[model samples]
Structures are given as structure tokens and as C-alpha cells.
Target chain A: EAAVTQSPRNKVAVTGGKVTLSCNQTNNHNNMYWYRQDTGHGLRLIHYSYGAGSTEKGDIPDGYKASRPSQENFSLILELATPSQTSVYFCASGVRGPDTQYFGPGTRLLVL
Target chain B: GDKVKQSPSALSLQEGTNSALRCNFSIAATTVQWFLQNPRGSLINLFYLVPGTKENGRLKSAFDSKESYSTLHIRDAQLEDSGTYFCAAERNNNNAPRFGAGTKLSVKP
Candidate 1:
């Protein structure tokens, strides 16, 4: 089975703090994505990477940044975290074309 | 208007019954994916299609690019199936996928 793991499953941060969520995939997929899930809004894409060193903005990428340093690792960075950014984050990986995506366990963040 | 809209925002069904969830997309979707979010907040992949149909166990899904829509049908619902069902669409030349608000399903015994 494809495996995707995320670090720091739960987190708490204060406003204006810098937060980083890490993701690792053993599937060897070339595409990686970052998304945030809220109560009313299902899942909104924040950032995605095609390959190493390639990051593209998604629908809601205003307060988030993504980095794909290697084929196995992708990270989402919040330079200045805010209370509004408190939501469940998920990372997914997929191969090229219309293939099934493997998602991580997800990380829940609380900005106080 | 929402780009991806799912019908029946919430649903409740008795065990052994069948139900279908639908998703309509305003975008030109080339592919579709279905996910089930358990009560524990873990999102599990159900089906992925490119204008076709796929069946896995008690779950069956169909996607039509021409109609810009997709549907998921559950047969003999079980308590473990109670959760939120989400459909995501990916347009040609677009790597970012758009997700529907999701249909929350509760299977009662």
C-alpha cells in the first residue's frame, strides 16, 4: 500500500509564530499537495509541488508556503501563523496523470 | 456559484439499506476522486476514476467528464460507513484539485 506520513500530528501555536508541518511519502510519487480542512469548507488546496524545488500556489495560498526539497519530502510553512489558520491540514501524493492519491494521517493545528 | 457542489449535505440511513451521493462540477473535470473521512478525522480513499466506473467491495463510483459529474453508491450500508464523503475534481492541465463541501452520512443500526 502507498504510505504517506505526517509529523507532529497535533500542534498548538500562538499568533505571529512560525509553524512548519512536515510530510513524507514512500510511494515515490512526483506530485505532492497541501490542503486545509475547515467545518463548512471541505478541503482547500494551499500549495502543490510537481517535483523537487517546484512549488505552485493553489486556491488558498495566501498565508502558506510549500517546499519540496526531495522526492520523498514535502513541507508546508506558515511564516506568521494566525488564529484563522487553525485547521486540520492534510498532505497527499500522487503519480502523474489521473491516478489515485495517497493521503497522510493529517495534522490538527490550533492557533491561540 | 460553487465550482464543485455535492448534493444532500447530510444523510442518515439504516443498516442494510443503499444510498447514492452525487457531485456536480462547474469546471471541466478530466478526473474525479472520492474520499471517506471517518469520525476520527482520517480521510480514506474510496475510488478514483477518469470518466468511467469502479467498484470496490460495497462501494461503487462513476465519473462522467462529458456531464461534469460523478456519483458514489453504497450497497448494504454498515455502521463503519458513517462519515463524510467528499468528491474532488481535477481539470486538464491543472494539478490542483477542487473538492466539494461533502455529504455527511450516518448509518444507523
Candidate 2:
């Protein structure tokens, strides 16, 4: 089975504080993604990386940034966290096309 | 406008009953994926289809590219099956998959 693990499974932050969520995949998939899940919006992609040192903005990337320092690790950074940004975040790793993307356990973030 | 739409936003089923979930795509999707988000909030991949049908145990899923739709059938539902089901469509190999609003399913014994 593909292994994808996320750090700080639950987090609480104050408004304007900086927060970071980390993901590590043992599957060695080239593509990694960060998504936030809200009540009705489902999962909205925030950022994605094709490989190490590469990051691309997704549909809703305004409040988030992503970093891929190595093939096995990806991180989502919130420079100025807000209550609006409070949601469940998921990280996934997969190959380029037509393949299964393994997801992490997910992180619950609450901004006050 | 939603690019991917899922029908019956919420559903309830009794134990040993069956249910079906549907997703319609407005985009020219080339692939489809079905996922079940368990109560613990883990997204478990159920099926990945490429314009065809695939069955795993009591769950069967079909993706029709020509029709721009996909369906998931759950048989003999169990309490463990209670969760949110989501379907995603991929326009092409290079583009990211677009997800639907999801179907929240509840199974009771």
C-alpha cells in the first residue's frame, strides 16, 4: 500500500499567525498536492508540485503557498492565517497521469 | 456553474440495502475517480475508471466518457459504509481533477 503521512494532525492558530502543514510520502510519486475541504466546496486544490523545488498554484491558491524540498516531502504554508482559512487540509501523492493518488490522513486547522 | 455535479446530495440506506451515486461532468472528462471519505475524514480511493466499468467486492463503478458521467453502486450497505462519497473528473492528463460537491450517505441498521 502507498504510504502518505501528515504532521500536526490537528492545529490551532490565531489570526495573522503563520502555520505550516507537512506531508511525507514513501511512495515516491512525482506529483504532490495540497487541498482544503470545506462543508460544501468538497476539496479545492491550493497548490501542487511536479517535483522537487517545483510548485504551481491551483484553483484557490491565494492564501496558501507550497514547497517541495525533496521528492518525498511537501509542505503547505499559511503566512497569514485567518478564520476563513480554517478547514481540513489533505495531501496526496501520485504519478503524472491515469494513476491512483494516495492521500494522507488529513489535518484539521482552526484559526481564531 | 459547477463543472462536476453529483446527484442526490444526501442519501440514507438500511443495512443490506443497495444504493447508487451519480456524477455528471460539464467538462470533457477523460478519466474519473471515486472516493469515500470515512467518518475519520480519511479519503479512501474506491475506484479509478477510464471510460469503463470496474467492480470491487460489493462496489461497482462505471465511467462513460462519451456521456460525460460516472456512477457508483453500493450493494448490501453496512453501517461501516456511512460516509461522504466524492467523484472527480480529469479533463486531460496534464490537468488536475475537478471534484463534485459530494454525496453524503448514511447507513443504518
Candidate 3:
């Protein structure tokens, strides 16, 4: 089975604070994604990487940035966190598009 | 517009009963994936299909690309199966998947 892990299971940040959520996958998958889950919005993709050193924007890419330094690590960065960004974030890895994706536990962020 | 819509936003079932969850898409979906978000907020992949049906244990899932819909059937529900189920569809190889709002299921003893 694929293993995906996220760091800082819970975070509380002040407005305008810089926050970073880390994700690591052990399956050596080429595709990694970052998503935020809201109460009524389900999951919205923020960013995704096709491979190391590659990042692409998704539906809701504003107020967020992504970095993939290696095949095993992908990170989501919020240079200026806001209350609107307070939601549960998930990380997923897959071998290809439209395929089974393994998701991490999730990170709960509260921006005040 | 909602590209992917899920039916029965919420559901309650008695243990040992059967239920079905459905998702309809407005886009040209080529593949579908189903996931279960547990109470603790872990999303587990249940099935991924390419216009076919797959069964595992008491759960059976079917995806019809031509019909632009998918269904998940759970037989003999258990408390452990209580969670929010989400269905996602991919229009093509280069497109990002669109996710449904999810169906929350509660199995009571």
C-alpha cells in the first residue's frame, strides 16, 4: 500500500503569518496534489506536481503556492495566511491521472 | 454549475442493511474514483474504475462513462463504514478531477 504522511496535524496561525504544510510519500509516485476541504465544498485542488521540480495550479490556487523539491516531498506554502484559509488540507499521491490516489491523514489549520 | 453532483447528501442506515450512493457528472468523465473520509479526517480510497464495476467484500461500485454517472452499493452496513463518501471524475488524462460534495452515512447499531 502507498503511504502518505503530512506534518503538523493541527496548526493555529495569525493573519498574515507564514505557514507551511509538508507532505511525504513513500510510494515513489509521480503525481502529488494539495487540496483543501471545506464544510460544503468537499475537496478543492490547490496545486499539483507532475514530478520533482514541477508544480501546476489547480482550481483554487490563489493565496497558496506549492513546491516539489523531490519525488518524495511536496509542500504547500501560505505566505500570508488568512481566516478564509482555515480548513482541513489533504495531500494525495498517485501514479497517474484518473487512477487510485493515496491520501494523507490531513492537516487542520486555523487562521485567526 | 456543479460538474459533479452527489445524491442523498446524508443517510442513516440500520446495521446489517443495504444502501446505495450515486454521483452524476455533467462533464465527459473517463474515469471515476471513490473515497471515504472517516470521522478522524482520513480519506481512504475505496475504488477506482474505468467504465466498469468492481466489488470488494460487501461494497460494489460501478462507473458508466457514457451515462456520466457512478454508483456505490454497500451491503450489510456496519458502524465502521460510517463516514463521508466522495466521488471524483476525471474528464481526460490532462484534466484535474472534479469532486462531489460527498454523502455522509451513519450506521446505527
Who wins the TM-score comparison? Answer: 1
- Of models 1 and 2, which has the larger lDDT? 1
Worst 10 residues of 1 chain A by lDDT: A94-103
DockQ of each: 0.84, 0.73, 0.71
Estimate the lDDT of model 1.
0.94
lDDT of 3 by residue, A33-70 (tens): 99999988899889999999999998899999999999
Q: Which is the winner by lDDT between candidate 1 and candidate 3?
A: 1
lDDT of 2 by residue, A1-112 (tens): 9999999999999999999999999988999999899999888889988999999998899988899999999999999999999999999998888887889999999999
lDDT of 3 by residue, B16-106 (tens): 9999999999999998999999998888889999999999999999999989999999999999999999999877855567789999999
lDDT of each: 0.94, 0.92, 0.93
Residue A79 error, candidate 3, Å:
0.9
| Tens digit of per-residue lDDT, candidate 1, span B9-39 | 9999999999999999999999999999999
What candidate 3 gets wrong by more than 4 Å, as runs, is none
Top-lDDT candidate index: 1
Candidate 2 overall lDDT versus native: 0.92
Taking all chains together, the TM-score of candidate 1 against the true structure is 0.97
Calculate each model's fnat, 2 decimals: 0.82, 0.59, 0.74
lDDT of 2 by residue, B42-62 (tens): 999999989999999999999
